[model samples]
Target: MTNTKRKWFIYSLVGIGIILISLLAYCIYLYQVINDSRTSEMDTTKTQLLEQTSYVDIHSIESFHGTNSYHVLEAMNEAGEDKLVFYPLEGEQRQLTVFDMEDMLSKNTLIETWQSSCGSCKLVNVTPALVEGEAYWEITYHDNENNYVMNYHSITDGSLQEQFKYPKMFY
Candidate 1:
């Protein structure tokens, strides 16, 4: 090939190589950005759920016998009677079924000597010592005798601390 023709060929190959490299780099950067965004979204969701958990009402069933037979479980809404078995404290809400309660209560500490209302109640093995100054504590219990178990943890350092699970017999 003549000098000019050879030069033209070489330049064409170099241009194609540069274009290919640019496209590859862009694709890699896009993948990283999407991955990072997804991770951040999940973290935000978790934080919101933790915050909602702090405000749901957790009370003793012993105190509720005369008030209302239909006790609304916390983290759950009044519609559909769905129990808040698990969810981000604020974003998504899920119900706890009868089987779910039974599973959770199976490991709970049964309050054998209680006389107020929950005669055969099962509570999580959580004590004041486990919660006093801590920021969170996971508690699980049977929502009712029907075998619905509700599991939840509390956020202790904020305005929502009053909703922390105290020993209760709502079952």
Candidate 2:
């Protein structure tokens, strides 16, 4: 081929390579910006949730059975009168419970009922939550071998409304 033609071909290849590299860098920068925005949005959502609920108090409860250890938390719900929220720290199944704070504190009927229902499981935390305009209790419990269980018990009758078990692995 002629020298001029060869030189033009090389120049074109170099230009294309530079353009490709620039595009890749731009894509990477865009991805990072998007990821950061998403993180910020999540933080804002969490803050909004806390503000909407107006939790008066937060409590952490820890329990152990044999070799298993359980971590639970309770938060008072100011948005709803006589309500508490409960949840567990880490597990395949995370549970949230909202129940009548007054009944839980005074009568302790929910705890008693839970004991009766699952003798092997121990209550970890109780929190009040508003679910679809209805008040509910989120209860976290730990059974044998560090197994985490979550139960939503009705405040009216202390009946188990929903339940979940933590998965062993995330993926």
Candidate 3:
């Protein structure tokens, strides 16, 4: 073969080899980036779960209010008292009510008292919670159309402190 032709053939082979090596290196870099991102996401998820568990202490309470539309969960605080946490099944608002157990048991007239104070909302359930060492009532109720409602009433004065309402559905 001619000398010039032989030189061109060697250069072509070198170029092809360089291209292949570059492609392989790029693939390896992409693999490492994807793996690192997945690991970071998993670590973030684990951390969020741990923080949530530490925030709410789980408790065993029977006859919690609501059907498939809402959820009421009981948790024991650091003071060894039950706290009621209310949230809608698909809504955004969440409420935490803390009171004393003995105060709730002695207040049998709480439902009747709430009925007159809460307008048309019917009393559903009453859970005790303690707020800053002060006992309060976490009242759960529903309107005529089954819309969920919550009221935080002071145990001492029977005055409403906070109220929450959630509609039946969200589009």
- The better-scoring model by TM-score among 1 and 2 is 2
The segments of candidate 2 whose C-alpha lies over 4 angstroms from its true place after superposition are 1-107
Q: lDDT of candidate 2?
A: 0.59
Off by over 4 Å in 3: 1-106, 118-120
- Assess every candidate by TM-score: 0.35, 0.38, 0.36
Q: Which candidate comes out best when scored by TM-score? A: 2
Q: Name model 1 segments beyond 4 Å from true.
A: 54-171
- Candidate with more favorable, higher lDDT: 1 or 2: 2
Top candidate (lDDT) = 3
Instruction: Give the alpha carbon lDDT tens digit for every residue of 1-171 in model 1.
Output: 599999999999999999999999999999999988865654554445446544332221111111111111233233333222322122233422111222232212323322133445465443211123232223334444545343333322212233333444463
